[model samples]
Target: MLADAEKNGPKPAPLIEAFRRTWGRMIIGIGAALLGVGGFFLMTTFIISYGTDELGIDKSVMLNATVIGSVVEIVVLVVAGRIADRIGAWTVCAIGGLVTMAVAFPAFWLVDTGKPALVYLGVGLGICALSIPYAPIGAVVSGMFPEAFRYSAVAMSYNLAGVVAGFVPLLATSLTGAANGASWGAALLLMVIAACTAAGSFASGSLMRRERAARPAGDRVEVAV
Candidate 1:
């Protein structure tokens, strides 16, 4: 099974085992993360096409969420990049989990505010929370194996994720329909995506953290690579 196989140790040849680790986790994590991200596009598409009725907002205000989210992504990317460079991927991922937990809570309150701009603020924070840990995930996947199989494993994961990315808009649309047939309602349904991310990612990060932490304290993470 994929789960059992993922938990297994590295092979005698580091490259082979590294291929196994990256193969199982990378495609799954990236696809899921993108799909979750694709939810933003979905929300925008729906709101742009459908309009925000429940919130009494104009189309221009709704677009601000994207603008704000872009800014948020920049902040997250810069900070996460530094952390990934310094602290190791797994620890960053774990910390991201805690940040996600805190971020998700505000979303619930933002919905009640009924101001589209405020909602955008909360959404921006959520996007930032989601993005900050992403740097480590890719690095972890890329470095899992020796040079031999790294290309194959990493490429396969990215390609598969690209394939899966196409399906996100459709799935997100369905989720919107299921959520009271309104675009804003989609936010509630989207939380499920976040929940799954926390579970699977925390698992991935925790596993890697344990593996990396087993090394001597003075041994730097880069040296482990």
Candidate 2:
């Protein structure tokens, strides 16, 4: 399938042109990226500061918990990828987002308890939830665009998400402060991101159908491939 795509793919066009041609799917792809990748930033990256600075967990303890969560994430990603392969990427993505949204508040509440075991549990759960969509999102976005500029579209969405996700730690900190030491601020942030991810993931299927309907029959074959 990959070889066939490479052989029959359309000539690469400007990134902007690719986006212009499929703006609806592009927007959905970007929304999916923002939440899927950005949720990871909240779970893994912002977690350290959220633990040590705000929750006052020992830095070493937080680091150890993070390591545990990372291990769990590794396992979950593989499992989720396999599940996505069997059940469908968008289905996995949507399920992941909903789980994350449902768990965000309670996970943060567990972390706020300052118990080491609870900390590990909270972090591990958060990482595992976030990793589900993270596993299948590359396939999701790649499938959103035609071969003509699939690479460009995927790069743009992920990179743009990366750029915004880079600021997530700062945003989490600011929100935490604004809430006057409440963990709900950061939790709300995660829930909001997860909501977007779930919504976008479900919407992507229909968007892909629309894109296929608009494409030439030959070009449409690449989408399924």
Candidate 3:
């Protein structure tokens, strides 16, 4: 029966129809990705420049700090992935976003202090916050749609977010300049991005439950990706 369905399943809905059916979750996923990945870009892609130019840290030191953060993030991604599996992806992601938002300003302050140890501590905190949600996002977003259109929905949302997030470094630069070289400007950007992710996480969880409830038991599919 499964093989027959694979060979003879109804053609996937048209693009517009797919979007109409799953727009709620797709929009939530896109918002979450835009903010989550935007925050990640602000921290990773732009942090070196921000630290060196705005905060007066050495360029080499900033580079080392980034490398250290990446290493720490690898560990965090694994742990967070495991935790998301046991508890729930959306729950973990929402918590991560709130924590990131809460720490954004303080993290920047630590970096602004120009002390090497404190700088590392601040950067590590930001990376950990982003990585926690980053781990399980693929699973959450891909699971939002039926199997027939899952790939298109997830890919479109993810890539759309990436396109916007690519500009984060430039936006952060402008924000910092607007604030007269104040790190708070950039920190504020991160806070907003984190808040979006947190809000989207909550919305996505609700939509997931509704989608499941609306489907007949036989039509429900457990998605791994």
Candidate 4:
């Protein structure tokens, strides 16, 4: 398998050309990655803090909620991937983004309600929404670039998202403090981030469709160079 892959691997020159051709779409994908991954980090970082400090919930209960939410996310990830395969990755991602955005305020509200069960439900729902975009995002980003540049483009975008994700926790915490322990600001920020991801997903999807339509019928399918 390794030998066969190497035989058909992309050439350097074509990889460069592929990057040049798809740079715009790549940018959109990177933007989506930043938001999607950052939002995930933001939620994970603050759920415990908010539950204990602001909502007066027990630490152990919050910890259990996080664990349960993670388990639900894993299951949702698989289901989301299967759905994306049937519909379209971008569509699934966009839908997920909308759901995440819609749920942000309510999730925060539920957490602030100071009910343990509601808090668990809110966290679980948020995780499910996060999984929707996440599951198919790998394929969606890779599809934005030609096969020749897929690896490089995907890696760069993903790493950039990681950088954003690393900071989101601190940022959310600061914002929450600034709002006098109110979670609405933090929730709003997440909603805005999710919106960016949704917009980017739609834009990248449109670009891919255009590229596909522009290809000549009899022309050789562009492989990895």
Predicted structure with the largest TM-score when compared to the true one: 3
Q: What are the per-residue Cα lDDT tens digits for candidate 1 across 86-203? A: 7666456556655665655575356336588676876677667767656565765554433445666666655665566555556656755676555444554445544545555555
User: Taking the tens digit of each residue's C-alpha lDDT, what string does model 2 give over 31-79?
Assistant: 7877767877887788888888877889988889889988998999899
Candidate 1 Cα misplacement greater than 4 A, ranges: 1-56, 108-113, 182-185, 199-225
Give the runs in model 2 whose Cα sits over 4 Å from its true position.
1-13, 211-225
Better of 2 and 3 by lDDT: 2
Regions of model 4 farther than 4 Å from truth: 1-23, 214-225
Look at candidate 2 and tell me the lDDT of residue 8. Answer: 80
Candidates' C-alpha lDDT = 0.56, 0.82, 0.81, 0.78
Q: Which residue pairs in model 2 clash with each other? A: none
Error of 1 at 106 (Å): 3.9
Model 1, global lDDT = 0.56
Q: Which candidate is the best by lDDT?
A: 2
**Candidate 2 local accuracy as lDDT?**
0.82
RMSD of each: 7.4, 3.7, 2.8, 4.4
